[model samples]
Target: MSLTSRAATSLARQTGRQLAARPAASFQQHRNAANVAGNPNESHAHVTSPFTRGASGRQDTTVIPSFKRYRAGNEQGNKVFQYFMVGAFGGLTALGAKDTVQNFLVNMSASADVLAQAKVEVDLATIPEGKNVIIKWRGKPVFIRHRTADEIKDAENTDWQKLRDPQPDSDRVQKPEWLIMLGVCTHLGCVPIGEAGDFGGWFCPCHGSHYDISGRARKGPAPLNLEIPAYDFAEDNQVVIGT
Candidate 1:
């Protein structure tokens, strides 16, 4: 045959062979993909699916969108629930604060035992003139004196204006013969000895403070008179130290 015809025949045969091999190559690829998916009859498209599809052709995991699922009428109800929650939290917080304040007040207030000792009552018939009686009231020493005539005269006649703390003896006592004052010294809260100082009243040896017969601060570090407390004579023969 001619050279050109021989060349054309060879070219045709090669094209036919390539065409025949394409289907086999495609089948082999399909078989390989099915084997990888553990099902020889399944298509590669099913095996490579990004998500599993349901019978309705939608992804099995699909859910209705939030905006599409929400209804306009439910908005007020949701807001009301939120407001209720906020108000409940605020109420609880206020209640806790109130309880804390009340508990603090209860703990800081004076106790029953302290309140029970607020006042002391004494009978004058047990005491005599020229004698000093010491008693406790409100956790402090109280000096209750039944003064003699001479002591009362000295206390009233003293020049109170010249003292460090100026006060008349008449102001210190309800009666001229009765003297009631806290024994605690004004300088350093020490207990002073009654009727035992240079002033013949009370003496605080701790700081050398002295008080007169009227419980007036006279010398040394004392800056004020001995504190007088509330008292009443209940009857002609009986005196109540604290009333």
Candidate 2:
């Protein structure tokens, strides 16, 4: 058979089947009506129709809601959890930004400190004779000396017992009493303590390093003498370090 002919025949068979079923359905409806009429005062129960109904037998529909129409309890909770998760992630990002800024500031401060240390400066008038004062030069501590007659004599004495390096030839201080040197200890950068008259010289308690009035390291574990900073005499009493 041709394809169009076969489709036509199948449709005809379906139509005939539906027509035959229609009569049986009508007969059953009629029988039910008759039975209902036989019983008088049967309290006519309401019946619902899909299409528009006449005033004789009309009833309201009872709607049943489908589960797919709304969210379940767990699904609602999941939405709330998603919102909280997003907020938590945002808070973490803010904290990370704060920490990054703080780290950058700390690095900048450290760089400034290094620069200050590379360039030291001082004034001569501030330091008195026979006494020493701590001055920041080139970002490091320096001892400026104002030698008295007695302290100058002590530097000249050069007694072997008092000094570890008596030669005074290979020392940081070029002069005996009127001296200037880096106050920082060469061993570990600790500033040495200088006694005006009682201790007689600079003493480092860190490693027992002793320095003369001229800031020359003489005794203890310190390997080298006190450093003489680069400086020049400004006037009669003025001095400038790291100029």
Candidate 3:
């Protein structure tokens, strides 16, 4: 037969079989309803329905839930188990987040060996009196000036009370001859020229900021004195900068 004719015949046979099964199901439903009416106290397990018939024409057993089923003794225990499971999951998640944050902070921090090199050691023997030496420490220029006797005398004699950023020379320096300070001008972070200002100290040509021999901001727009870094005389001629 042709493909179209075969499909039509197959569809007709399936439709006929369905129509024949419907009447049998209706009859069974009517008979079951009559049996239930006749015996009102009949057991639910032996009840028959239009649907759910096995090969031997018996209905599958169905359990009807009562209100007491929900109130079973294990309900309280199940709730507690659920709460414990949620708490355990949350704790594990928090632990993972803490570990991630700790690892991130550790990666951002400097290593132990690098921290050990934080301080810079300078030999004072290489520097001469009446001259200034600029060295890099912690990525900033440090002014290490070995003052002459006349310069020290001049710094002490200068009226610190009249200066814009008032600071005594004795308080600024650790020792009389050695004057250590940062070379950066407080006005706009410009490096000042050493031994060249009006006061024979340091001059910032960028904004005409002047510093005295004692590293005091003596003139111009510079707001504060040259910053003094942390340093100590390790030996007779050796100094260590930074904590």
Off by over 4 Å in 2: 1-123, 159-177, 196-199
Model 3: lDDT of residue 167: 90
Clashing pairs in 2: 119-138, 120-137, 120-138, 121-137, 129-146, 130-146
List, residue by residue over 122-228, the lDDT tens digit for candidate 1: 78888888899998888788898899999999998999888778888888888898888888899999999987889898889999998888889888998999898
Q: All candidates' lDDT scores?
A: 0.84, 0.68, 0.89
Model 3 RMSD, rounded to 1 decimal: 9.0
As a TM-score, model 1 comes out at: 0.62
Candidate 2: C-alpha RMSD after superposition: 19.5
Candidate 1 structure lDDT: 0.84
Top-lDDT candidate index: 3
Shift of residue 67 alpha carbon in model 1, Å? 8.8
Task: Compose the digit string of candidate 2's lDDT tens values, residues 1-243.
Answer: 999999999999999999999999999999889888896336444633443235654443553435664766688799899999999999999999999999999877756656656654455566666676777765677777777878676666666445554445225444444577777887898877778223477888887877766555577777766767777666656665664
Give one digit per residue, the lDDT tens place, for model 3 in 96-133: 99999999999999888678767989999999888899
